[model samples]
Target: MATGTQPPASGTDPRRAGHGVRGATRAAIAPRHLRTDRWWLAPAGTAAGLLAFVVYSTWRAFSNSDYYAAPYVSPFYSPCLAENCVPMRHGPNWELFGGWWGLSPALLILVFPLGFRLTCYYYRKAYYRGFWASPPACAVAEPHTSYTGETRFPLVLQNLHRYFFYAAVLVGVVLTYDTVLTFRDEQYAWGHMGVGTLLFLVNIGLIWAYTLSCHSCRHIIGGRLRHFSKHPVRYRLWGWVGRLNQRHMQLAWASLISVAACDFYVYLLATGAFADPRLF
Candidate 1:
């Protein structure tokens, strides 16, 4: 009855004092919110879209079929270096392992672009919100009790994004070469253009845009520079990359769609599902 400590004021919380609500008891609530605003739609759509692409691409990669048509190779199977790669279908046929391994040709090359996208800054944010529901949306609360962030294990590998960017650039170069080769006919003679050629060209352009607009590329171009006057060329390059970075999200999605579309187009041509119209 004569306790020295005073009770909290009628309308205020004692636990909310300097340390906001650290040890406060949580309300026994059901769902976080009851308002009907279609909040779950975004993540749902993202999950569905990404899942469809993953399934289709994985199937195509493992099927190892119809990845190439004369003068056009699917972006999924470019730089075909496997011995199992059909000489007529996948081309290149670098025979890197000399027919020893009976693996899918896509196994040899999809990793670079896959790694690039997996570690992409925008993709990381997209999937984190889309798939993991790590605080899924703007006002949503995460299901976890603690936050560990990206400082450990699998997430830590995100640091390798810069290296993956390098690999992606080389892959882009290979794809560009494939695009150039598309100018030739089945006999390797130049001056041919088809519906497939434009598709490959557009796909490569989108990929280059996406890759160049990457956050890692932006940093490499301008991160540590002290004085812009000292390096006007680098500064100018950085400015260009900065502009692209501003649209990185759009480019990322555009490239994803285009790459898949390009591969599917080649698949159709290879399977004779569709005839490539000559644009020449």
Candidate 2:
């Protein structure tokens, strides 16, 4: 021992002997964080943007009447499983939930895509900083006294992100089908196209980009492979996914905004706000 120096405590780093470890002790700093510049702006902006989307999506989900127009259906209400769906032909016609179910058909199907977003790894970072303020930004101290991470209850459900990825893929497929259906006119003629069709095309494209770029999708395509040389096909696909994954955050926001805009366009048409101008 060096000249009456105290011994290092258990489960701590020697280099950080004077500094604090999370869940052990607070650092000797006086401020909440030592950031000098405008560090709070990013988290504040994230919180505002996320809150706006939640409010808009929640309102649209409940007000389901305007979500469906001929040859166009909102992404939020696709695979319309209920019999009561407006213009039921837009749906699969299976009516899995039966006519007895009276709630918005959007509610029935939104869970899958919603679950996918809620459990998304990127979104976890987003909301944890934006909504929860759990260490809102880099080097910032969280107000929470303790952190359990995603180990308990609702947060633990994040492990189901992989499963939700499958559901999101299915939803993407359904949205593609819906977009294809938009090629037809109200008379059901196959040769017609409209401005809404273009919007649908753009929205679905963004949706697929976001969905395929998911961390879970990347893992499913690339994980568990010990030898890249042994599987050239998977390796190529993994590389492609890796490129997309780099833009995951941008794709996430773009797709979210596009889906909402697409649905809003459908709502405008359904409400007789204007006629969908034909491109043909």
lDDT of each: 0.85, 0.88
Write down the RMSD of candidate 1 (Cα, Å): 3.7
User: lDDT by residue for model 1 over 20-94, one digit each (tens)?
Assistant: 556766554688765468888888888888888899889998888888788788888878877777776334446
Report the poorest 10 consecutive residues by lDDT, candidate 1. 13-22
lDDT of 2 at 32: 79
lDDT of 1 at 98: 55
As a whole number from 0 to 100, the lDDT of residue 112 in candidate 1 is 86
Provide the lDDT at 170 for model 1.
Answer: 97
Q: How does each model score on TM-score?
A: 0.88, 0.88
Deviation (Å) of 142 in candidate 1: 0.9
Best by TM-score: 2
Q: How does model 2 fare in lDDT? A: 0.88
Off by over 4 Å in 1: 1-36, 89-93
